[model samples]
Target: MTEPLWKPSTQRIAGARLSAFAQAMQARHSELEGSDYFALHNWSLAHPEAFWQGVWDFTGVQASSPPKAVLEHADQLPGASWFPGARLNFAENLLRYRDQRKALICLLENGRRRTYSYAELYREVAQLAAALRRMGVGPGDRVAGFMPNIAETVIAMLATTSLGALWSSCSPDFGISGVLDRFGQITAKVLFAADGYFYNGKTCDSLERVAGIVKAIDSLEHVIVVPVVNERPAIEGFAGKHYAEVLEATVTDIDFAQLPFDHPLYIMYSSGTTGVPKCIVHSAGGTLLQHLKEHQLMLDLGRQDVFFYFSTCGWMMWNWLVSGLASGATLLLYDGSPFAGQGRVLLDAIDEENITIFGTSAKFISALEKSGQRPRESHDLSSLKTILSTGSPLAHESFEYVYRDIKQDVCLSSISGGTDIISCFVAGSVTLPVYAGEIQAPGLGMAVDIWDEEGRSLRGDKGELVCTQPFPSCPLGFWNDPENKRFHEAYFARFDNVWAHGDYAEITDHGGFIIHGRSDAVLNPGGVRIGTAEIYRQVEQIEAVLDSVVIGQQWQDDLRVILFVVLREGLKLDEALQQRIRKTIRENTTARHVPEKIIQVTDIPRTISGKIVELAVRKIVHGESVKNTDALANPEALDLFRNLPELRS
Candidate 1:
């Protein structure tokens, strides 16, 4: 048997929050007294009411009214209700700590830094909440933010949710149309934006786009601007108010609205790469409870830990990062490009700020490896403990690179979930050992399994990732999805009453889950199913191939796999490199997984949150229109793949 990459020592296991949680639960409910994680996980699924109630109590969730019952209609996926009769305020729970501990540390790409203590953060939110209250923003009102991932953005969101309002935000880099397509659907009453933001040593102005968004959305009543690029941005054309001016009322306290457990706290949007984005509404209690469980139990977060996830306001990880405040952990926020400072900017922050838990996308980690930036040899990383990665499958080589070059003792956890749940279905557990390329465990109480097309559970094989039972953090529903027709069709259409998460996945012998790729983007060639990640894992091992994207194209009578390569600077994809690519894939994977044609391109199109858009690229390859180019970070890259002369033969 192969050995794990790393394992927790006896002291580490004994000190883990999971161990402490298990001990406390066992004292109250004797059925959960085992030290085995899978045993505890099974008990959680079987007695979900007791498990969730234990989590709520263990985390000391600050609720206005205790839950009358833990769950209602527990068998229904869409109809199940959690903590139905409880009343709580999301912001109030997050802001429960008022001491002088550092709550937020803001780092910008342009060498700007700001820090906010817990007391200061609470005061800021109180003032902002008071100002929002005067504007008549109340329960069920929608508030929008077109800002960067700065302290102000978090403050604004807390203030909005404090008044029982729903908050939605997009990064400042989003185009005007993308902003309108999202905010237009919800008819937001207030908008907050930054004047401009810095990216890769370039200043990108956002006020012009904000003005355009204001004119397009007639429901907007107010626009507030924060100065980043300029001290006093010219807001002449638009009647926008400065962020500081709006908070001059000097209010020092907040009246947090104690709303229903299922009241809307946030309105997240889908990638919108295929069509208009779906506004996914998430409940306050569900989001808070699920985040507390993931943060405290899964990540082993504590008050002394400095937690950081490199995410923008547009991505769901930003929401996940902010929830660390509830656990009393300091949050580190970074804006602008992850590639700034020769890709050492984030690495430098780890040493400078003494970050304990660092989170980022799998693409960032791969890019660091490709750039030959070895932090183990370059920086002091004694304070760092865990690294969280998502947004795509973490290639197998990237896993090796981290233990080899990044840090030997750190836990590298590649988690997977989406905006659909606003949390992870399969995530990391501190109690588990680190494997080569696997998510450590299924989220407790998730009832996660891999099933074939017939809905029968499979072992050691690739299949659809499904959750037979519902979990908290399941979205309330899609906005304007009356009768839930579209919502049901989106998640439950494939299986009767089961949540069909659209991911091509496999269960490993270690009892961990490996996400191959998006199920919808699985390549079918010659009647054989091949996941793109399986090919990517092998191709990325070759140093010359900087990045690649694969798609199955229609041929004479069947589908053929086509590959596109993005070579390093001044390097060309000659015949030798093509043979090496095919040799690597054919030897590691099956011959059918090899691409029929290998073409070179300058760039690959990805979403604004940095996920490669395979479906959109496939549509472009087949001479079809990509409905929403605004959702892409580089829309121009799609043109490089169109009408390729090589594909004609």
Candidate 2:
């Protein structure tokens, strides 16, 4: 029998918003009375309309007009219309709270802190929106942000969305070509950027890159630069205004535009490692409702809670984090490397800010554990109720590390979703027990399942993760993909009328989920499919291995697994270390899962959002052209894998 790492107390469960939602549903629908969480999930799928409508009501979505119908053409995956007649503003819902309570707390790498109350936040957005309106940015216009995760970035997004304009953003670290590939596709009319940003005790300037981007993208008419590392940055090369000067107008009100539920609100980009990034557009109503459900019901977040997620403007989690404001929760926005203070920056903020919900990537948690910084013994984390992990699957040892080293009582929710949906398919439930290496449940009304190649459902077996029904957060469609050709092919073509999420996953017996890796990145060695994450879990447990990336190399008449590792300083890849690595993987998984070749490298290449790019490395090893080098955080690392003598064997 497998034991759970932690379980919510009776008092905690009773106090959860999910429990209250269950009670409310039972009261409305007699058939749902006395149903457990699993039973309620099934019922939600059976009656998605009622479930979503109930969520809209429970979460108090501020809409100008109620939805006439919850769903239309429910059978079509790509074509389904949700809340067709509803009229709402995504910014209006997020900025509904107008009290004096703290709405945003901005923390920087150089030990700077800035805060804004709800009333102050509204005023800032109001002034910014007026400025954008003066610049002719209104309905259907696109505004892009090349800034860090700070209050101004959030304010810019809110101001843009308030006027029914679509907003897009990327972290300032993106190179010129990368920014051009994404923001160029959308033809953004206005750009918001920071003069520079601070990271790892260094002040990196963005003016040169922003000027380059503005010069390349012919559609940009206006540029707003926020002063970060400098009080005033020279914008002589570009036609731009200071962000502070733009907000100097005495505007005190926001004229929220009421648009259709399916109106485009955000333009997100797919990591353009293989090609030019796809510009995915998400609807306002869908994003609002989906985020609200995940926040209020799944996280049990309320006005009294302090929520924080360590993310850059480029990542989807930043979008998700900003939605916490709709729940009236205060948000902590941090801008810097997560390892600024020897990996204590984030954990220290939890104590200083009294953050109740903390979110970060799996890699950070693993690195923190390896650093031997045990927060349970060093920090006061009594206010933390939840710790969320995403970007990749959470390792089993990392799960145990959370309970053993971080906090015993907190819920460690390892969520899985991507920029495609802007929300989660499998997430944590506050009312459920915390199981090691397993996501608590498929998100409510997500209709998530694992299916084999033939589109047959599987249990306790790795397969493609699929959603058979339409959810609110599904992308409106890819920008410029007229007639929905590329959009349909991206998701629906894998399975008829199903959203193939591209993740290789399994449904555990505990009614939870275990995501192995991405289906595209799955290694096929000797005709057997192997998830890369399966190898990563075991290799990461080794003390000498700092990081690793594994891929299948096309060898003589067969495919063999190749692993590249970054070792601890002053360490070398010797026979003993290689054998020990193979032994660990072989003992935990299968002999076939062990790497055929282990090569030591200085670093592993990753995306700007901190996800390892296995496909890019594979392409480099195979002597294929990587279409966009700008998409990688460390494009130079690809040179390390090129023409390796060991792989030639």
TM-score of each: 0.99, 0.99
lDDT of each: 0.92, 0.94
Model 1 CA RMSD to the hidden true structure, in angstroms: 0.8
How displaced is residue 187 in candidate 1, in Å?
A: 0.2
Residue-wise lDDT of candidate 1 within 44-130, one digit each (tens)? 998999999989999999998988999999989988999988999999999999999999999999999999999999999999999
For candidate 2, give the lDDT of residue 107: 99
Which runs of model 1 end up more than 4 angstroms from their true locations?
A: none
Measured by TM-score, how close is model 1 to the native structure?
Answer: 0.99
